[model samples]
Target: MQFKHPEILYALFLLVIPIIVHLFQLRKFQKESFTNVAFLKQITLQTRKSSQIKKWLTLLTRMLLLACLIFAFAQPYTASKNQFNTQPETVIYLDNSYSMEAKGEKGPLLKRAIQELIENLDPEAPISVVTNTTSFSNTNLKSIQNELLQLPYAPNALPFEAALLKSEKLFSNKPNSPKNLVFISDFQEQQKPFSKPLDTSYTLHAVKLKPQVESNVSVDSVAVTGKELGKLKLRVFLKATGPTAGTVPVSVYNNQTLLAKATIDFSETNVTTFTLTENHIPNGKIVIEDAGLPFDNVLYFSLNKPEKTKVLHIHHQDNLDVSYIERLFNNPEFEFSTTFLNNLNYSVIENQQLLILNELTTIPSSLINAIQSFIKRGGYVLMIPNSLANLQTYNAFLEPYNMVMQAGITSEKRVSKISYAHPLYKNVFEKQETNFQYPKVASYYPVKANTSSVALAFEDGKPFLVTQNQLALFTSPLNKTNSNFSEYDLIVPTFYNIAQQSLKTARLYFTIGEENSFDVPVAMQADGVLTLHYNEQTTIPLQQYFNNKVTITTTDIPDVAGFYQVQDKQNPISTVSYNYARAESKLSYQNLENLEQVQVSSAINTAFDTIKSDTKINALWKWFVIFALVFTCIEMLILKYFK
Candidate 1:
């Protein structure tokens, strides 16, 4: 019904000249009378009415022919009803993360999406696919869809908005108009806020995956192994959601050996803390009871023994804050060291894993250079400023990295608005059955942030918790000059977060969960070992390394704040792991209300589902042209031969 170029319709004006010429059309009737006139008069009298009607019909046919020619030149045809042209360049934002595997029809959410995709395809139309990739790639539609169909469903999730924008850019080569985009997913509430805007030029189809409410018992979280030697402590938490299942069975393993078994209840949140009697398990794994949701039933992880952390504490000449902070890392497993502003040994700051700059009234530029280099090489710094800490030195040290501290602001209003989103917050409540909320941002420093900086804590209305690149920083306005330290609860979690973030380095990092056997770059001899000691007794060997990493069963390593030693033992070369936490609480599904209204049903009829076959296309439009030709031909031969 639409025209590709409707403007050609003006060609109808060409018919005016033909009509004018016809008006002037005349024939000189030879006045041959007599006998022939008598016979002609009798014949003309009998057929005069029929002949007049034929003349008008012939004129109308000529006008129709002119109109048909003009219309054909205009290139008129049907446009796509999918908010764009029928031959749209489309990108399908397919949600294939682990979370997409939630049970639906016959299997999971992803299966339904696949089925719907097959049914809804605008036969032969271009379509690209996108999933949960850590970094996006630019690729065309067909190949992307093939890759998606090959991947299995999972429980992992990705940001909704990010994936859409990525898909848009990939299909940008198509004409600006008549583009197509489809988001096939379960519009979970968290994902709803990030939904993309509708594009009329690009037909948007939300092939939503239907959600059904189901109870989920997930391993909400687990805490660091142990703080001291022989403690070998751990806290494993279980969260019961939806309909309670009373008690669930849980088992754990070390390598292939079954270590412990227990029953977990669902009436409330459950926290199970147990110790590892064996000092060297090498690798560890945990298997929870299968509760229909198979993706989270068994968790395989690894751990490392405790190791010493070489710490550098910076302070003013007469400041006593250094001593108290220094006392926390005094255990032999930790080599506690100190320096005062312009006087300390520079080499200590370079080699140490932990750097603590205290109530320094002034900081020399030399330390600033050391701090910058240290962070660049995977060093962790903890800034606990007393009122006396030098604002100028702190600002200068953080300027290049885009973190700044404003001078001389002090108040203890209480820890008001806490940032529960940070890992620091998670670690503090890891052992509690119920998630513990931070009391309040007591009288403390207000933290600020830049683009790369993420707030990990807060006080008043400012950010007290922060991370830049991978470096972690916490600010406190306590006891600066007043010598009155407040908000002591922050001490443990702050240190815990520092240790965890500092020691984070992936054995191998991949954007997608579907991949296996990632390549490791650091060559390990056939039997050489790269060891990571958590405190004293526990040690983790880097089984392999390449491309700046190796394959590590994340849970097998100890996530404590310390220096890791990668030793080939025979050749004895060393490497280390900077802090990064593997588990994120954000993965926990909070909505008990199942997403049940999504269109994961049997294939429904839609404009996109039509397939083009010569038989079918010819049956309609071709018939129109055929009938038009047949009628026109009859009219033409009748006029030509009879006349």
Candidate 2:
């Protein structure tokens, strides 16, 4: 037996007052030997004995009534042998991920779970409710009822193992009592095998909610396979919950206008390709019709018209290598130009995206200063050394940047290895071929550098092509007399990539609830707040601008997937797209056989019943009050009829 308010039990001491009064009353009887002193002696003795019994009975009734009233106020309760003597601290973990949106037998899984929890919860016990993104701790079940009703599906999800560890920490400094952690979730298979062992001190209960329909299809992702003037080839990836194949309708739309539609014959393969004409549209989306779960059914994407790259080649005189470089950048995508060292204009270097120096014997001080300033402002430079290049002049220009040119030249070296993982080679080739011939150099400048990444190495383990920050270095000049590098297969991609990397473009899309950042190129002196505009509304995200680049970082993303424009006041500068995470697409669930170690329940009601049966608290205070009333009635009958 336990008293909820034990301090009130001290009222039982008041029983001493009735005992003293009864004794005083016994002594108050006068020594009356009045009428019938001798004749009434026998009668008096009988009366006194009967009266003494009555007085003692009345006193016992009064004491019993007072004790019962005190116990009633104390709220005494009897705990079952299996129950804890102290009130339990219960933590209920509610899964609010998108997976919980699936329909259950009763209704929505999350809603049904919450309703069952409230129905079976002990009103007197303290409870804590933990959701994927929020926590309500040290409160009663009734206090959080309104919050539970208003809960929405969260974009983020918590793994079962992480949720268990978080629930355990909530009871770290709490008073000694029975502790319990209850989980209500669909128990996705991906969340199996907890990262850490459960604390044995806590009683763990799992209420697994099963969805009525298990089939689900999602538009996983989209990738660009090929691109030309105004046309793009895209491959859409789809995934299904099960192997049962069925056809699905897929469509591409530019805003509300549908561009193309196709019926995808579902099968074991996950990828399907489609050719989409750009038609001058800057943004678009891919949609697939799916039932059950709809969060990942649409994918947002955007297309930016290729910008023209400005290239300026500075040389000592007209050479064949300079013409080769011009041919590489002569396409509509590039603004190519050439100038001699003596005819160079310093102001033109500021607007050029890339500056190429071809076989220069010496670099003047003024030109060197301009090149250094351009590199610092996010410009790229590619240097090709002359066979008889001035080693002192090259060293003086490159030493400050942690690079230098060697004094001698080597003959008969072949380009043997390529760094395929480098960003310059991203999407350049479908796959590397094993029997492709490499370019050979008859005589080349031996290169030396302190800190640089080897992009292309020779068969002799020498650095043929190296890069340091915005600078790219080739050990040998591209003339036919020195090497055939300018005429080989690697020439086109190498030069085109150098120019392509100079333009700073924002990514087309980002995943919600993840760290997303974008870079925007602006003038170093440009100052103003950048804002993101969506649905005719504007919001300012966290940003840092430095060195002509503005980096925007934010996690307060849009709830719906769509295209949003980035602007500085009124001029739209870039487009950004956001989509929901694909983690909850598959409807696979954890196997019941693997969860034998934990207490598992199929329904919320079953879980509630289990908790109730394990923690039994019988309220004895009401019974005590009933006994007090019965005793009072007996005393009243004795006083009225016996008299």
Candidate 3:
């Protein structure tokens, strides 16, 4: 047992006052005469024994009360044997992640945690404090208390296992002392489990904070539908974390103007599609009002005006499929042009988004080289076969890309199946019909190539339409003389989708803290440098330029999730959007069962008690105060009734 204020114990000498008063009262009393000798003698005999017993008991209680009061005022406590020899080395892992913004009993969970830490920590002991992004080592509690109070919520989070390992490393070379690690966090369930067994040398403590509310809703992702020219549609994916079911108000905005608003019943559906009639919106966002966790309630997205896709059709002079090809590429979204293989311009090949070879008898050496260079620079090509063409020239042209044209033409095949899930067919149809008509080809060459996917296959298990990287090939010509493919309903969509997929545009959205890279089609010429703009601020990101293509990488420009634009000086080249990570939207937490080798406490005060218990220092001041009051009450009762 130890007294906090041991010098105050000198007041124990005041116990002499009670002893002196008892001694004075015990001095020789004057003899009193009794009215009757027999009655006086009996009264004297009975009263004397009872009076002596009551007086001694009263004196003992008074002396014990004085001692208890003194002990209570001195603030006595018992310390473990090890505690007296050295101070404990404590490391506190405080979770400052955005999830810690949850409200607790007193205030924000983080504020309450800081208050509890300040009140319970040993002032004299040197401590270490670690947050998600920063740490301070070998500092006293008083020195870092202000910094703790001012610590802001961090955008990133650290797992419990990593924090524990960091704490272990911090104490590796420290002087020998009783070691302790206290982890104060909400213990979100997304944290990965410990990979290996923990070191047993240091004692571990956990303080888990509980959120005031249990329900949360978040925007999971956004996807664009249909690349048409008029109105654009966005599909927003939302998820509810708890069992609550109700209507949530969702709104879409372009820049600062409100475009559309709707209320969705999340109990029935998790996806909502919104269409914006306003064309050419460079920046936009969708917001939902959710008070439980507002960080993930808003999703940002960007849209570029549909650019005209430049298509170059290279074909033979007598090709019969030119009319069908022209009709497919005549939409307002495409810049369609045609040229014979003999008169093809190599300079124009670099400017085209797609190239179509319509039943050509032979591929020129220079044309094949230009086609290879075009595909390498993110261009698409579609080829149609000529049954009686020069197979040697075609195979020689394709051999460098691991592709070949077989010599024989088969006349007994029809397209048996279609890969409806391929990106080439995305958003082409509302729904796939089971009994759709299949296109039949009278004659086609069996292709031999290492292709990425077979878009359409023949009944004999041969590929009808095969795609190798950026190149798409057909085994049969589209002319009416060889097959009915030119007249089939599938030909229109097949050619239209290829033209649509060739346009280069920014991605729909990116997640914050994830690496983002964009490929701009504009060349870096003269003194032109790429700059990104968010709100009113401008920043230049890391950029590399080659062959009229500028690749930009953003390192530290965006600190928050929102819509941003990349430009060369004043010309806006592309727009992109960023959204916060959705991992924290999952409010599931870890219980004691999830953490195996650590002591856990839900309350901060309880955690302090656990630490004290580990050191064998049990506080006795409260017990002494209670005992002092009880003894005083007993002495008063004896004095009042016994008299």
TM-score ranking, high to low? 2, 3, 1
Candidate 3 local lDDT, 392-496, one digit each (tens): 878876786677778767576778778888767776667875686677888888778765588888877788888877788898877787777777788888888
Point out where model 3 deviates above 4 Å.
Answer: 1-97, 110-184, 191-206, 220-238, 243-245, 265-277, 322-332, 376-378, 382-503, 515-518, 542-549, 553-557, 604-643
What does candidate 2's lDDT look like per residue over 1-643, in tens digits?
A: 8878889988888889989887776464456657668866777788788888887888898789889989999888876433434566678889998888888898878888888877888665688889987899888877888889888888667877788877787774645576777888898877465332544566778888999988788888887777777677878888888643488888888888898887777764667787877734557788989776777778888766655677899889665456678788889778889999989999999888789998898888788899999988778899988877888888888987788777766678899888887767767778975578889887776667768888888888788888888899898877888888888879898888887766545555688788777566654346688888889777788887645556687685565567888788788877878887889877888765565456788887776677777677898889989989988997897777653
Candidate 2: global Cα-lDDT? 0.79
**Candidate 1 lDDT by residue in tens digits, 548-610:** 234443342443323344444434333333222222212333332343322222222242342
* Candidate 2: C-alpha RMSD after superposition: 7.4
Task: State each model's C-alpha RMSD to the native.
Answer: 9.5, 7.4, 11.4
Clash totals, every prediction? 58, 0, 0
Global lDDT of each model?
A: 0.54, 0.79, 0.79
